[model samples]
Structures are given as C-alpha cells and as structure tokens.
Target: MKTKKYTLLLILASLFVGCEDYLDKIDNIEALTELDIFTDVNLAEDYLDAGYTYLITETTAKSNQPDILSGLVMSDEGYPGRYNNSVQERYQSYANGDYLFLMDLNLGVQQRDTPNLAVRYSESWKGIRVVNTFLENVDLIENADEETINGLVGQAYFLRAFYYHLLTKRHGGVIYLTENLDLNSDLARVRESYESNLENILIDLEQAIDLLPVNWTAGNIGRPTKGAAMALKSRVTLFAASPLANTNNDPQKWVDAATAASDLINYASQNGLYQLIDASDAINLDVGHGGADLFVSEPEKLNNYRKVFVGPGKSKVLPQEAIFMEVNDNTIGNGGLVPLPRTYLTSGYDIVKGNFNPMNIGATANFVEKFETKNGLAIEDDPSYNDQEPFINRDPRFYNAILYDGVPWIVTDSAPLNTSGVADLAVINENGVLGVDLHDPTSPANQLWRVRNSTGYRIRKWVPNGFFLRNCCNAEEDFYVNNMIFRMSEIYLNYAEAANEAYGPAGKAPGQSLSSLDAVNVIRNRVGMPNVNGMYTGSTSTLRERIRNERAIEFCFEAMRYDDIRRWKIAHLEENKKVEFLEMRWQGGVSAIYPTGFSFENVEQVNLKKTFIEKNYWWPIPSSELEAVPDFGQTDNW
Candidate 1:
C-alpha cells in the first residue's frame, strides 16, 4: 500500500490548523488523495478533519471582507472605510451596463450582479465536491463496525445537505446531485428547475435527520448534531415555502416548513439542545453572583450566542448566546469576526452600543427600531409614544444593542468619560468615516460618511477587542470573544416562524399555541418585550411586523439580518432602514433635535440591477460554471 495517497482528516475536528506562530511555518501537506491515505481509521479521521476546514477558514476578523461577502450583509450596510471597492461594482449594476448579469438583474428590482454571486457559488460548489468525493470513498474503510460506518455515512449525508442549503439560500435553483448520476451528465444547467433541486435536498436532509444521532458526545463539538440537521431543515423549508421560493400559493410547502420547524423546536426544547440564557447575564453575566466558573471572562467556551452579541456585559469567555461556533486560535491568522452594522455603536465610536445610531444608514436605518407600546400599539406606530419618554418602554433589544448616552467601554483614551458623551463619540468622526479627523474641515467628502484615520468616535462592530491597528494577521483578544454562528434564541425564532407557517400540516393552526408560541413568549418575556399575538397591538400586520422587527433587533450584528430579510422577503429598507430623528423639548421649553435614522440610501448609492430583474427571482448561475457545461446559460432578465 502506498501509505494511501491523500486523505483530508482535519475537517472532522479542530485538526485543520490555519495559524502558525512567528517561528513556525504551516506544514504544507499536499492535498491528500485516496492512494496516499485511508489505510485505517487514523487516515479516515484526517479526511473527516479536512472536510470541516470550511467552518474555520478565518478571514481577517476586523477586515471588511464580510462587508460585501457575507450573506447577511445588506447592500447599504457596507461601511464607509470597508468595502470601498464595492461601490463601483454596486453602481455599475444599476445602469444595466453589462450583458453578463442582466439575467440576474431581472430577478429582483435590485441591480446586483453575477461576478460576486459566482464567487460565492463557486466556493459552495468546491466544498460540495470535496464532501462528494469523501462519500464516494468512505465505504472503502476496512472492517469498520456497522454503527461507525453508519455514523460516517450520516455525517457525509449531512454535509451534502448543508452545501445544498447554502446554494439554495443564494442561487435558489441549484442542481440536485446523487450517488448514481453520471459525472459528466450531472454537469448540466438546472438552475431554472429549482423546485426539483429543493425537493432533492429535502429528501437528503430527511435521510440525514434519521441517520444522525440526537446528541453527540466528545470529539463531536464541531460536528453537525441532530439539532443542527433539524435546524437546517426548518430554515430551508421555511425559505422554500416563503415568497423567495414562490411556491405558487401551494400551502403544502408552508405546512411542510411549519412541521419541520415545530418538530425541530420540540426536539430542542426536550433535549436541551438550546436554552435561553438569563436576561441580565445574556450579555452581562454576574460572575460573582454565581456565574458558572467556566465563564470567568472567556464565556465563548460556554457555547452560547445570546450574551456574546446582542446581550450586554463583559464576559471573559463566551457570551450566553452560543449555539454553534468555529473555534480559532493564532493558527487561523486572526479570523474571529464580528459584523457591525453601519450605525452600531453607543454613538459613533462605541462598537458595543447597538442602538444609538438608529438613523445612520439613509436607505435603511442602521438600527432596527422597537417601538414603545401605547394602548397596546407600538409607541412609534401611534406616534404618541415618541412624545412620552421615547426611549422608555421600548424593545429590550434596544438595551441589548445600544449602550445609550450613558454606556461605557474599555477604550484607550485616558479621558474620564462617563456614558454621557460616549454615544456622541461614536457619531462625531469629523476627521474620517471611521477615523479621528480626516474631514478636511473643508470638503463635503470629509463629512459624516468619510473615514477618519483617528477613528473619530465611530466604533464599528467589526472591531476586534484590543486591535488598534490592522496587520496582515495579528493575534488579538477577540479570540477570547467567542464567535457564535448559531444560538438558542435563533432556534426559538425558527420555532416561532416555522410553527406559524406549519400549524395546519401538523394538524394545528397557523398561530402560536403553548407548543409554538411558548418559544416566542420565552424570548419576548425574557427581553421584556410584548408577545406577538395579543390584545396590545394594532392590526395583525402590526403584530407580525413587530415579530419581524424583534428578530432583526435581537439578531442584529450577528450576520442573521441579511438572510432573515431575504427569507421573509419583507421589503423594509433595502440596505439599511430609515434613521429616526426626534425634535424633543425636554424639561425646559427649549427644544432640541436628535437624529435616529439608520436608512441605507444615505450611505451608499446601491443600484441592485444585476441581481434584480423583474423575473430574476434568484441569484445568477455563475458565468464560470456556464462555460464548463454546454447547457448552462444566464438566469433571466439580464
């Protein structure tokens, strides 16, 4: 045996090393082939390890790479300093200037294009190919126990489903592949026939669900658990049933979505796959007050997501919201990341503050607003809530997201600042967009949206803790701040949405009951927000809109909003939402105006043409893929 040619194992665990210290060089292991490796379980494990490299391939934690790349980043959410290159790409698409993406442009009203779209798709396909290759050869393992064999196969199926989920989320009409398909025959265009692909994916996912174990023990932290499988099913089904899927008014898809989501939620609630973190400790855990010893500062180890992002407090390790996260060390070249919305800050400089910049994004408010309820109506909706202590009695997400005028952070400034001017500091970067004083004090370009080298008061959510400057790869304290890819709260929201849609299919109704509504209520009551279907709101749209708003407010800055909007297909603000401003006369007769708008049109000029054709309901099939296959063509309008 030639020691088995090549096998990828690091994908199975925390084995694929990306970071090397100053004195060390990353061991350049040539991609393993079947002939080189796979002699035994050890080599098989290596291949499994390599398979998961996708999860931990760290980008610059603080870099703006996610500004345009992440599925969750809205078009206008790209900040002033970050994604500067994207401005042209975005603008050109609006002009209907290219032949390549007009088909894509015809999808939605947006003018986005195929190049970037293709890149994302290509990346997904590459991973899919790797997993497919792994599945083809895994059966070659010698004398493996049936249980072990099934476990390995289950994981392979789950991976295939996972890849399909990503493709469907982005392009919609992805091709379905199976074990028996001829390789060349399979390489054909099927983007137009997305329904079949989705059906294919659903069948694979269901099989995976049956095969995967309910809970995984040690050596499986990073592996997809039964909960993950179901969660994905719920998410994908909901997507499939939604307007994005254009189910032709077939309520069956909705019923299917609801059933999957409800089933997943029930499993989670029963199995403790997810548990809500205490509200106060969701962000600011009282360690001295009996906080788990494990959460001294590095709460990431706790493996929760709620506390780490929207939640408050200075936890040493994992914030409470962790559901699933990729662990990174110095080996990954500084890749633990955070996606700060354009207006996320106590003011302009405080990254931790979540709500103060409500009006920063001109197109869509950088911050999603939760209104104070008056006569059971959102105070903002009633318009009278603004007059009565506007900030009081609003969504708890505001507190979780914003530090207000009185919040504080661990800043390098020796200045003795209370929370008073901290909020102002976040917004007052006259020098640059995210810098200290580049405004030229003369040119309009030097104004609000410009980058301030000194970093002005603008604190971006992407700022890794303790990073003062950018390096190719710098080890920062952010490695301590756990990266939460999924959390319990999200699972709850998933449950709610799924149940609302799934009711009838499960021999239930489309509204919340204890089984479904309990998830929503738990999160709502935890945050001190109102329940969705109650006597305290206006129309059903009003209440449902509140639900959507709560999800955005709760999941803000966590890379969920972009997809949430897409899945819901709600057209609020394209990039960012409107910035809210209130001219209030407080205490004295003298009145003052404060800006709260966070809309996107004010930020960047986004055309959204290439990705937005009248019939272009899906992202384009990448142009590169088109050339590879004889039958592949463009998407639609373009």
Candidate 2:
C-alpha cells in the first residue's frame, strides 16, 4: 500500500512542535511516526497539546499577547503610553472612527497578517480548525484507553468553546464551524445570531465539563480542568446576558449566568479544592515573609493579594485564585512576560537604572483614584484621604499595583533600594526648583521623578522588586510568573454581578443560597476590606454601580475592564472620559510640608476623548475575512 501523503501522527507532531511551547510540554513527548500516534497512548495525547497554544498571555504591541495591559489601555482604567507607535495608533484608530480593516488590532490571536501588525488577534477560525481536526480523528487512536481519550476529547471541546467565545465576544456573532473544513469545501458562511452562538458554546462547555477531571496529575498541570470548563461557561454566559448582547433585557439570561458561576463556586467549596487565597492564611503559612518584599519591608507580610502576584516556591506556585492561567516563563523574552518598571524609570541622563528601554507608560490619575480608601470610601468621600499625601492610607491594592512618586524604586546611590525597603524615596520636583534640594530633580540622588515620564505612576502588579534592570527576556533566577486567565475571585465577582442583576442587591436567585451582597463580601472579607452589606444599604441600582467598581479594582490588569464597561453598555461615557493626573508641586521646600509636603493644586487634564459611536459597542469584522465571504455582512457601524 502506498503511504498516505500526510499521516495524522506526523501532522500532529509537526503542529505540536510549531506551537508556542504550551508550557514547555510537547518537547517531552516521545517521538513517534505517523502510525505511532494512534498506537501509543502518550503520542496520541500529544495530539491535543497544540490546542493550549491558542491562549493569550501579556499584551505587547508586536506580540499581541493580550492581557491586562491591552484591556487597561482600551478602557478608562488606564491609558496607552505608546504615543504614535502601533500600540497607541491602533487604540486611537479604534476610538476615532478609523476603519477596522485599516488598523491591525487583535489582542490575543497568534496569527500575523503583516510583519508588525497582528490583525488577527480576535480571529480564532484557525484554532477552531485545529480543535475540530483533533475531534474528527481522535476516535481512531487504538493505544489510548477510555480515560485518556475522554481527557483529550474534553480538552478539545473546551478549547473549541473558548476560541468561539473569543470570536463571538469581539465581533458579536461569527460563523460557527463544528466540523473541520476540507480543501474542496465551500468557504461561504454567514454569522449566526448572538443568542444561538452562545447556546452552541454552552452545549460544548457542558460536554467538556462532563468529561474533564477536577484536576490533572503532575505532567499536565495547566490543562483545562472541570473548573476551567465551568469558569469559561460562566464568563461566556455573563457576557451573553450583558446589556449589549441581551437587547431584550432577559431576566432568565442573568439567572443562567449567575447559576453558571455558582456551579463552579459551589463545586470548589464543597470539594475543598479552591478558595479565596486569604492574606491571613498565606501569612500563617509564612510563604512570603522574608527573601524580598514587593511592598513594605516587614518580616511578616499581611497582603495576600500582593503575594498572589509575586510569591515564590512550588508550594505557592498556583494560588487558589487561579482557575486557569497561561503558563510561560516570565524571565524569558516574550514568554510569560510583564513590562519591567525599571525600563520605564528615566528621571535623568546618566541614571541607567535598568538594562534596556526607558519606562514610558504608567497608571493614569483616574485609574489610581478608582481604588477605594482603607476605610472603603472613595478618595473624595474619605475625610482622612489627605489630598497632600494622596498615596498614603489608600487602598492596599493601590500600593501593590501602582508605583507613584515617594514610592521607592529599586535603585539608590548606596544600595539597590525598592518600595519594600526604606532606603530611598522617589522625589519628584521634576519642575526643577532651586532652593528645595532634598532629592532634587536635577540632583544625581533623585532621578526617580514623575516629571521625566508621561504618565506619573508606573505599573507595579506582576513586576518583580529589588532589581534595577532584569533583562526583557533574560528571566533572572528562572522565575516564571504565568498570566492568570480565570480565577475563583473573578467567579465570585461574576456571581455577585449576575445574581444582583437577576434578583436584587440583597436578594438571591431561586436555587442559590448566597445573596449578591454575600457574594461580594466573600471576596472582600478575604482581603480584610469592609463588606458591602455593612457599608452600602442602598437599592439594587446603587449596589450595581458598586459591583462594577469592585470588578475594576480586582481585575484591573487582568484585561476584563474593557469588556466589563462594554457589556454594561456604558462604554460611550467611560471610554470618552478624560485621562486625569495628580500633579505634585513642592509647597515650600521639603521642610515646610514635612513628610506630606506637596500641593495637589494641579489636577492635570489631558483630552484623550475618543469617538465612541453606538456602533462601536462591537469591534468590526476584519476585511480579510469579509472579502473571503462576500455575503458575510460587516458588523454594525464599521
């Protein structure tokens, strides 16, 4: 018999090899020939390995990894500091009525249309094709037993559902393809209705949930578990039931979304598999006591939230908050990467604090103010929130997530200093005053000033401390911080929002035991924040606003802000809002105001107003796909 042109095993092997590491797993699989994939259990399992590569990590302009940074830049949460570059240009074009086809702006997809522009970020047809192909032939595997087969099949279904979710979320409704397409098959297909699209996705997720295990063994740490399937379902349903998608305002849809979220929460709680990683509990374990501190230089750290971002060791590897994460080495270039703050710290000419690149982008004034005070009141509302010392006594998350002036950078003349250590403080007299010489802007000791940069504050979340310049890809100490996708905390918030919408603020859905307020409190109590039930005794509308704000703070850099505002149908107002900044001018040298001696007199205003049309509720369908299927109509207002 003449050998088949391309064997399924060989095809899968080549595909797996080409995949973006997929947590460095494919390399471990034994090499097998075309027939070996079907006859060998390990090789057959490797067939499903490539599907994991479709997931996104950190967001960079050229890489288009698509995580917290992209979402922040797109929404009112933060501003894109990449002025005039592709990252800045793409965002500007999206906002200012620029044609979607003309601009290349996909946040997560790996495919590249051109060299620099990743136009296919939202496009998942190729990924779906790979998944469909696996499903079509997986049954032929002779060596894999029922359990192995079920695991692979379940993952394929979950990935297919995820890819479809990515597509539908971006372009509203997309053409759903269940079976893999052939060479001679017709490419013509029209977009489905939003409701129908979600229904089909839900069906796939249910199947995945039924087949997937609660957790995987050693070799398969990052594989989609039963929780992941349910988490995706909950998130997908949450969006489907949102105001933008649910045009009819269906109460049942909200119930469905809430129920979906509650399913995972209930299961996790009952099984004792996952819970909110409490600060007190993490501290009790003494996981993050010493070594190096991200925030304050105390021996016993109290912030579990900050520990969730940067704690070391295998025991602390995957926090309970992580339901699903994109596994990559943070130290490696472009793999599990976060923007280093040192690269951004440029206050003077010879102050080469970091290895390469100057830190440009930072936390916008509006984003910084979004965090509630320690007393759980808005900064403006909190009487103790000193305008002079705006950074002090603010939300713990603010200190952990943002790097403002007076917040120490990891560089000093005597020793390598950081926020955790009290050696050096960032003195921003960037206005260049003559008499006030303590850590002056012009002086060599104080180059860590905000006047040298565009956005006054720098991003602190997911960045390592105590290092002046870690190479972009060098990855010191082989430290890898994976970008978390779905976590228990998000599910808690999802339940809070969805249940509140379905029933009322304090009310619970038909089958649920916890009220919306209770759901919000579950997350807040873990972080030692005041509960919503105790603070806000307002109506459902007021609670709804509070729930939205909670989501903003919790999921800040995780990339949910852009979608949350859009789904809430308040994008037009939020996206068009001005980017605000707090300007700190010296009052009368450092001695007059003492420690808190600065003027909040100047609230710098920048007009970052983008053209937000009603049609902008959904991103435009890419023109390349449009040309391929001429019958497929473009999204509204494109």
Candidate 3:
C-alpha cells in the first residue's frame, strides 16, 4: 500500500477493467504509479482528459434539471410543459421553495428517479481534486517541451478556476481548496467570503492566460485557449460586481469587469484570434433536408443567424464567432435529445410509439414580447405592431429564432431536399371549443390543451430547418449539434454592459474606441436590425434597459437568462409573477386547410406561479455537504 497523500488506485481502476488486472498488465504495458503517471507525458494528458470529461455541455431530457434549463424555467423565460411528475415538482420547488433536495454525487444517475436542481457538490469537489492533482504532478513530465508542458498545465489551472467559479456562483463563498486531499487530510473548513473566493479564481485564471497560447492548431480544437481564460475572468468579475455579490454595488468592480472584457476584446483583435462573423459569409444553404424554395427566397436571412449556432450549416465547422465550444462529430459526445417538432409544433407529423411524443417545452409568451420591430422600435412603441397580426413586421431575429403559426415547417417527406415552392405551415391555435374538433380529438392539428405548448409560441433557436428535420426525427438518430458554451457575441454584450456601467451609455472608457452604443450596434448590425443610436434618445438608465433587452433578445433560450436577471438583482421582481402564455384565436377552424394568420386575443397565465424570496438570489448549500463537514456553513437564508 502507498502512503502518499493522494492515491491513483480508484481513478486508474475506473479507466480499466479491474484493479488487479491493471496491476498484472503493468509489466506488459506500462507501470501504473503516481511517478509513472507524472513522468509519462501521455499519462499526464490522460489525467487532464479525465478532468475535462466532467464538463457538461447541454441539459438533455435524461439529466432533466441542469441549471441551463432550470434557470430559464425558474426565471420568466421558460414554461414547464409535458415533463414528468418529478420535473413538475422540481419546477414547483423553484417557484415556491417548497421542496429542496440535497446534492449528491449520484444525483443525476439514470437509476435515481428524483429530479435534482443542484449540481453535485461531491462531483465538483472531485473535479477540483483532479485539477489540483494535475497541477501537483505536471512538473515531473520531462518528455514534453516547455511550451507543451505550460499549455497542458495552464488548462489544469483554468479548469480548477472554472470549477471554483461554478461553486462560488451557485453557492457563494464555498470551502476553497487548492491542494489534493486524501483520507488523512483535514476535511473541515469554513466558508470563505465571496470577494476572497473571486480573488482566488482570478489568480488561477491570470496564470492560465499567462501560460496558454491564444490559439491551438485544428487538431486541438475545444481545448481552453488564452482568450477563454480572459473571457472567464470577465464573466467572473461581472458577476462579482453585480448586486448579489457586491452589497454596496461597488463602482470599482464595474471598472474591473470593463477592463477585463476590454482585455479579451483587445487581445483577440490584436492576435487575430476571433471576429464577428459577417451575416453574408455566415449563411450556408446546403441543408440536409428542406423544400426546394426553402433557401430560394430570402435565403440570406434564414441561413445567416442559425448557421452560427450549428456551424456554417453545410460544412458544420466551428465559425469564427465561436470563442469556446465542445467539438462533436455526430457519433460521440452529442446530445441524445432531438428537440423534436412535436414538442413545439402542432403539425400533422407521425409520432412513432417509443420513438417520439409531443413533449411540450416552449418559450414563455412574455419572452416573445421582448423582440423589437424591424424599424428599431419595440412592439409597444411601434404602431406597426399589429396585435391582430403579431407575427408580421417583427425583427428578422423573430424568423430566425421562432417558428410561429403560419411559418414554414418542412417535416420529413413532406418536402424533398430541393423543392422550394412552399412547405406546410404550423396550426397551433384554438379558442375554446370553436376551433378544435371535439369529435376528432386524436387528430394532429386539433387543439391539444393538455399536451400542446403552454405558450402559443414554440422554440426555434436551436432547431435547424430543412434537411435537419429528416435526420433528427428521433433520439436513435444522431444530430451533431454543438452545444455552444461561449461566443464572441456574448463578449460584445458583456463589454457593452460593463462599459455602460463603468462610464455611462454615451461616454467611453479610457481605452475604449467606441461607446456602449457602438458595441450594441455591432450585434444589431449583424442581424440587419436598425442601429440603437438612431432610436429614441434616453439617459444612461434608458440605455441600460436597452442593453438588458438586447441581451434577452440575442440570447433567448441559450441558457443565460436566469443568471442575467439574478445578477442584475431583479429576480424578486421578475420571477414572482405568474408565467404567461399566448393563446391565439384562429378565424378559421383548427381543421381548416390554410389560413392567413391568427389574432393574439387570449394571453393567459399558466397554472404555475414563480416565487423568488430574498434567499433565492443564491442557491441553498446542499444538506449533505453541511452534514458531512460540520465546519462548512450554509448559504444565508437557506
């Protein structure tokens, strides 16, 4: 038995068949020891790969309650649809704080039936331990050159900081650990202050930036780059400066965040690491499935915005707009959930038993109201916004992001790959018993008040059109959708937000070449939306509202809304209201063939009511951790 503080026994055993078998094969293959692992560059790299494996990209139906989905569902952005009883209860827990679950390492295991909103504290601790173990042993690797050593070691540092940031953000001032702990090591530790925790995180990120290269070769895609570290620093500082962390709402923290974001922007620009993808160049019409005229009319508009999320559509390679993302080759590391149209669409598509169901999950009606008109005016401000015809004359992003009633929908076999005249349209409206056929309730287009969309709208941001429809029909089929973690557009918004906070909307910071308006306009111009500077002039507070609105519009359903509202310290205001859903009244019957449009007359509240108490700003510290280490303290109000 080894007496070293850390042991590689269990981790190594997990990588192989059995511990005894691994030991027996060591003579034929390679010796397995801490010294052996450290001395061998390949073994050291394997350890880092283990560390990276825990990094989650998307919240799928299987692990139903990641913060990416929960955050939005808990916030005003999403409405719970056809989830199971546990998921429904989880949504209720978020709203009223009625039932809270303890965090466990095996929380999201398929065997476990209960839904868990919290990330496993134990898993996060394990991740931290893995990173610390790497940092401690990396120096012993002599086979690799200095640059290679630094690059790998720097990733470890960045990952350590990343896990710590997640912990601090979820449960403020968690027990901070750097060294790898073993059975004999002390486990009890007091919680650190949020400021101190952020400082430690920033220190690791700074080291990562200093050591990591700006860009890696094509072979090493998805590895954290220097820009990723810098971007992370900006995100951390931004959250730290928010009302939740900064009780006084410190002005200097805003400057700090602004400076950090500016550092990334300046570095990426100087190094030529990334740039905003031009709308024209971003469009790729080579879809796997779509009607002939799908890309024929206004192809530039349909293909431009969605291509960034799914890579340049045809080639499906990472666009320059991507700062850091998980690389997927369709066969492995891809999400099993297909985001099927039945969940959102009310069209006549076949639903094979065990293959697909109309599992409802759509955007909230309130979220759809945030989009601006094409003429740079809000729906409320623009006289052109017709409540009778709400879908028309809206932002182009509306078409890019949503598949509303009357919009083109090309289901499998409904349209060939090249036919372009027009595909079938979605029929998802029924006012009371008039529009729906009570006699034929099983019909696809008939109104489904029970299992259909809670909101009148369906999500279209991640859903690809045309050829993608045929390929992504069921979970068994593979859909290589890259779960985007961070993008350059988010950086632009972060800078605009921090810059506006640091130095009012119109004013520029010391090193800034453009004001907050210019930064926002860059994103707007990409989508062909009218510039913000030409709109109604307002104070810094007004511009602040516009910036927040822009973020909501640009990043809807991308899993950033929950944190955005909370960090802004407005969760209590926004979250407590009842979730609203748009109910349209079709002039023609639901079974009627083709219709021009429907009227948005019945916008009603959902059954669920969200309640955000003062305690909700920070998640509750899991009872398991609190009980295991008595010295560990609970988050306030838990």
Runs in model 3 with CA error above 4 Å?
Answer: 1-31, 57-69, 102-117, 280-299, 311-316, 330-360, 413-452, 466-480, 533-537, 574-576, 588-597
- Cα lDDT of model 2 by residue, 468-536, tens digit: 334343332222243677888888889999999888887876667888889987776676667764446
The CA-based lDDT of model 3 is what?
0.61
Q: Which residues of candidate 2, in runs, are more than 4 Å off?
A: 1-40, 57-69, 82-85, 99-123, 280-300, 312-316, 330-360, 411-453, 468-482, 533-535, 574-576, 590-595, 601-607
lDDT per residue for candidate 3 within 1-638, as digits (tens), equals 13223232222211211123223434643436667777889878877776765554323222322232245576677664444334465566566764245333234434233332344444456667667777877889979999999899889889988878777777788756676554555566688888888989999999999999888877787799999888889889989987788889789998888888888778888888768766733222322122332233234545656666642233346668777776543331244434322222221222112212333356777778888877778888887666655565566667666655534544334433213323322234333332221112353433332333446665666544432322333322323344566788887888888888888877665776867788888888887776884454366677888898899988877767778887888878843356776666555642223224444653556457677777877876656556666676777877
Q: How do the predictions measure up, each by TM-score?
A: 0.69, 0.80, 0.82
Q: By lDDT, who's the top model here?
A: 3
What TM-score quantifies how close candidate 2 is to the native fold? 0.80
- Clash count (model 3, backbone only): 9
Candidate 1's displacement at residue 380, Å, is: 1.8
